[model samples]
Target: MPATPVADPFDALDPVARRATPRVRIAVGAAVVLFIAAVAIAALVSSAATGGGAQGTIVAGGGAPATDLGVAAASDGGASGSPRVATPPLLVHVLGAVTRPGLVELAAGARVVDAVAAAGGFTAEADPAGVNLARPVVDGEQLMVLAVGQAPPPATGGAGASSGATADGTVHLNTADVAALDTLPRIGPALAQRIIDWREANGPFTSIDQLLEVAGIGDTVFSGLADKVAP
Candidate 1:
């Protein structure tokens, strides 16, 4: 046969080249498939990284509710919850007419009665009624009890300054005799006598409020008596 006329080099295919053409096409197709797969994988990895970062941002802080700035919860009370510090026990100065008239160590919120109990309770001469047993005690405060017929030290303006009546004409609640007490408003001879009787039975009057404890004295009578006396 005459030599074949060839326009391109590839067109002049011998038996060996013709046999290799299918393999070359397959290699090129494989290279293209690998390139597309790598691009898709790269996009997926980038998307995953961005999504993870967004999730982390939300977890850090967003859409959180307001609070009392944790003030109410910071302590069972202020300076109370801090483990490094502790509140000291109350040092109540329980003096006069208690069995042990001195400072008594007590817990917070202790009452006068508790202090009296801690100080070995009231002496036989101690006016338990005069001590305001129901009143809460204070730290570093002076609580003085009285015996029968005793008067507390004078208050400002000479109130309760005398055994009978002060210059301001206020009757001393504890030391006033029946005649002096009778001078008060609504106090007749019988009521005046009763005032003295109550002081003898109870301890000395620590507060004029004690007038209500007398058998014949009521709120109406005590109201009339309130401004006329001091203790």
Candidate 2:
């Protein structure tokens, strides 16, 4: 046709444009990879800066650890687990011939000696022979210590000679001790002591019939003791 369009040698030799396109695509891909790497590195650094996943951590008053504080609390609770029990006290009435007389509180199972001590012991005129200090005391019982050289209390009735004598005719209500008084008909140690207590509280009996005035004594008791008792 017009000499085959006169073949262009320059066009056939030029591969510069095609090579340049491949280089540009490669550069863009490398840039994208660098940006992703930078973002990943920054995330990792932030995670390391702060406490990430640790658990069960405590901060005490002085920044003590959780384990230390927990152990201390457990120790305290264990030490106070059981409480102590207290014992009950005894109330006693101590009167007559003591430095300080009235009610006194003492430990349980206390003896008369303990009661006397609680009442400030005995006074100068206290006659220890009148009481059994070694004996144990009961809650509501009264204790009385007689004065030294004190005579038996007077009887309620007018004075009379000894009446209800024992087999030896020597027993007397005012002068008899607990043992001698216990020998009286229907009279026991307790009643004898009661009689002594009554005599000490009131005066000695003036007549055998005055025994009726003492506690635990009635007409029958008086009749039994009528011939044996005296003022």
Candidate 3:
């Protein structure tokens, strides 16, 4: 019989082939691991860029971090959140016999004495006795300080001291005491006190019409007094 085909048992043990097969498998496994890692890294970077993470990140002006952007926004909000405070002053007109007579600004609840003091006090010729310094000053009211020995102007236009009497006779506004003032028509004790108070606060009245400026007196009361009272 023909010699049987020679069996080469060492073919399976070829050194180069054995070593190269294991090396190829190891290289393919390492390449797959590296590809997976690259994909994961790319996903992380995309999420951060789009601000999709729980602690969102922002690329601000000049590529500033998210924290810096938040801080800047907070600062701006704080600056505009506070409110401003304001307080208005009272304006008054001070006239006659003061060293510096004109408009003066005073705090609320200021008195006539405070206004006079603001106008450099009274001049030596000023008659302080006629002015009630303790009176509370009203806005837009003119304060006229009288000069000593000055005579008040005569009443005219039927508004001056009465030349005729009404049964009990007319009472003088400048000279009348509280009891005397109460005798005129519609003149009660309270109204009388107000008149006296007004006369004391302001200097002697130059005309009966000036009575209208008193706190309590109005057109109705003035008309009633017009026929009977004088400056």
lDDT of 2 by residue, 56-157 (tens): 456644544564666765756644347545778888767678999999998978988999999999999988877767666656555556678764332222
Per-model TM against the reference: 0.34, 0.34, 0.35
Q: Tens-digit lDDT track for model 1 on 1-231?
A: 999876876678998998899999999999999999999999989989887445422212342223442454354254334555556889876667878888899898888789889888878886555545666655665566777557555333432333367767688877764445656777754676677668867878888898888888899988987887887
Off by over 4 Å in 3: 1-87, 153-193, 196-231
| Candidates' C-alpha lDDT | 0.69, 0.69, 0.69
TM-score, predicted candidate 2 vs. hidden true structure: 0.34
Instruction: Order the candidates by TM-score, highest first.
Output: 3, 1, 2
Q: Write the per-residue lDDT of candidate 3 for residues 173-192, one digit (tens) a residue.
A: 77654434655667654676
Clashes of each: 0, 13, 2
Model 1 quality (TM-score): 0.34
In candidate 3 the C-alpha lDDT for residue 181 amounts to: 60
